[model samples]
Target: MTTTCLVVMGVSGSGKSTVARELADRLGWQMAEADEFHPEANIAKMRAGTPLTDDDREPWLRKLRDWITEHDEHGEDTVVACSALKRRYRDLLRESTARVRFVHLSGTGQVIGDRLAERSDHFMPPGLLGSQFDALEPLADDEDGTAVDVSGTPEQITDTALRALGLQEDAR
Candidate 1:
């Protein structure tokens, strides 16, 4: 059977980590946060309020793709929380061997910025929220993914994503 990788994606502060963790726990899949794949330099840049250029993201995206492929080789389904803001970035991720899909956690910039302002543990700053939204390209019709609104509670959003993605019944 082909392994599946659900990439919970969106601009930063869109609750990607919260929703991805819920999905992974409910589905009994291994989970990873995209921040974990970033090199120290990337993290530092974001922390310093500089948006990452595509060149800075290329190697990081490749690392994520490789991670998916490695787990797929082991027949393990996975979930990842990532700020896959651009269509090209998503396209690169789809190059993995796993049947990659996305769940876009989407909301207005105000909402996400509010959440980011309250977050204290992440490396990304609230000031960078604008840059994230500026770069985000919503899921295209041709993409194998669904977009979930972030207006609701985390559980509500996760439920919506599962239903939209046709994975509700598979939840544990």
Candidate 2:
């Protein structure tokens, strides 16, 4: 069987982690949180309400890419949660040897902002939600991915993504 790597992507508060975790569990794939790849400095900068520059994100992105590659080499299906906000960042992820696909979790800023405001444990400050939205570019037509609106619960979003990606049957 071919291995697949699903990148659950969106801005802060778009339910990337929640949906990705559910998807990975359903699919019996390894799951990773992109934030775990961030260096202390990057996390500190974001915690300070500073938007990360491309330079600051390069190493972090590379680490995620390496994880994808590692899983691919093991012929493992994997799911990862990441704020692949920009097209370039997504492109870097697609460089992995595995069959890389993305699920873009999309929601209105107000919706996401409300979520951010309610969450207390995350390192990403609620104020950075605006910057995240600004940086986000929707998945283009040519991209190997689908965009699922975040208007539903996490389970609904995960089901939508699986159906959109033609993985619903596989998950069952």
Q: For model 2, how does the per-residue alpha-carbon lDDT over 67-158 read when each residue is reduced to its tens digit? A: 99999999999999999989999899888888889999999998999989999999999999888888889999999999999999999999
What TM-scores do the predictions have? 0.98, 0.98
Residue pairs with backbone atoms closer than 3 Å in model 2 (clashes): none
Clashes of 2: 0
Candidate models: Cα lDDT each: 0.93, 0.93
Evaluate residue 103 in candidate 1 and report its C-alpha lDDT on the 0 to 100 scale.
97
Colliding pairs, model 1: none
For residues 1-172, could you state the per-residue lDDT of candidate 1 as single tens digits?
7899999999888999999999999999999998999999999999899999999999999999999999999999999999899999999999999999999998988888889999999899998888888888999999999999999999999899899989999999
Candidate 1 regions off by >4 Å?
none
Among the numbered candidates, top lDDT falls to 1
Q: What RMSD, rounded to one decimal, does every model reach?
A: 0.7, 0.9
Model 2 CA deviation exceeding 4 Å by range: none
